[model samples]
Target: MGQFLQSFIFVLIVIILGCSKHATAAQFKGYEVKSSSTAEFNESVVRFIESQKEFLILFSKHSAFYRFPKKQSIDIQIRDFLEARSKTAVKVRVKYNPMTAEIQKIEDLKN
Candidate 1:
């Protein structure tokens, strides 16, 4: 009887863990892009964006990439990628600063 009860309790715990709410909720991620080291930051940002399936958020108001000489090329690439993804059923939000966290501009690709 003792062994059977232990087995049942272990199975119940497993079921609860497997059906966690976070498993279905959208995940949130953040990245910091600085003007002095945009190369690495750009690469990381691209990877992060690509891996996302449902949502994306960016926080970088003073990014140097905007001031770079090759800003046009880099900007177009990122913009094009986001535009393509935005055509799908994904949600995207970007913030230039943390002060306006509640005022996220949501981009619904389904539209």
Candidate 2:
């Protein structure tokens, strides 16, 4: 009986770990933006924005303002639209907290 109980507990632990891994995998499936333009800002934020261009375009077109939560010192949001060349054109607006010098929000303008 004791061996059976031990085996059951081990199985429970394995199941818990497996579920946690799945949760993390799901979390990582979301899109992130990364900026490629020469605009000077925090490199990390730029990278993030540039990476998620598809989401950014949708966000800019639909939402009046898109915000990056206060997680790091430099948070940047990129606003993008199409140009005459059919290329993606982007403008970056930044908001920073004076006390912390951290970027709080970024807004992209509509064409």
Candidate 3:
């Protein structure tokens, strides 16, 4: 009886931990880009935008990539482009995780 109880408790703990982990992962914030415009698309911005578009189309079709976590924040994207240009002389630092089809993060040191 004691052995059975221990096994049951172990199973319950595993179930609880699994559920909490899944719930936390599900709660991660995501952003969707609404529009891409020429006004914001300079040379560096253009490259970054193209890469992002390709990532979205070829990789993360369902998930939306955001410049920021906020509802309407494109500043982070723009800043990332500018920073990449300054350091690498080209738009870089854009990362795509093919497995997840998600842009893990975007950042710019320029601002």
Candidate 4:
């Protein structure tokens, strides 16, 4: 009986962990770039910090990558792009605010 209860609890824990999404909702209380031209760049990410969410990529197997991980909010589109590209490393062009250094847009670049 003890062993069976333990197994059931373990399964429940696994299920809960597996179904969980982001531990917390992304909240950033800063200005938005609704009408800015913003700067664009193609760069790679050498590291990822889960505490902050945002991106623009180019990361070939090169050692020279961009410095990053600012605590900013990312839109749904950017989040989706990152999730889709999670399986493979690819290059991307990012439109970002130079003043705030917040990524506003991101798109995959053609090789």
* lDDT (10s digit) by residue, model 2, range 1-111: 999999999999999987865444323212233433322232112222323322222223222222333222222212211111113234444444433333344433321
User: Of the candidates shown, which would achieve the greatest lDDT relative to the real structure?
Assistant: 4
> What is candidate 2's CA lDDT for residue 42?
20
Q: Write the per-residue lDDT of candidate 3 for residues 1-111, one digit (tens) a residue.
A: 999999999999999987865544333333333332211211222322334333221112223432332223444443333333444433223343444434444333232
Over all chains combined, what TM-score does candidate 4 have? 0.39
Can you write out model 1's per-residue Cα lDDT over 3-94, one digit (the tens) per residue?
Answer: 99999999999988665533322232223333322222211122223322222433243322211112332334444444444344344444
What TM-score goes with each of the models?
Answer: 0.27, 0.28, 0.30, 0.39
Ranking by TM-score: 4, 3, 2, 1
Ranking according to lDDT, highest score first: 4, 3, 1, 2
lDDT of each: 0.35, 0.35, 0.38, 0.48
**lDDT by residue for model 4 (1-111), tens:** 999999999999988865443321112222334636577677543343333443433344534333233343544434444554554555566556666655564455652
Q: Output the number of the TM-score-best candidate.
A: 4
Q: How close is candidate 1 to the true structure, as a TM-score?
A: 0.27
* Model 3 alpha-carbon miss at residue 97, Å: 19
Candidate 4 RMSD computed on C-alpha atoms after optimal superposition onto the true structure: 7.8
- Provide backbone clash counts, one per model: 1, 14, 0, 1
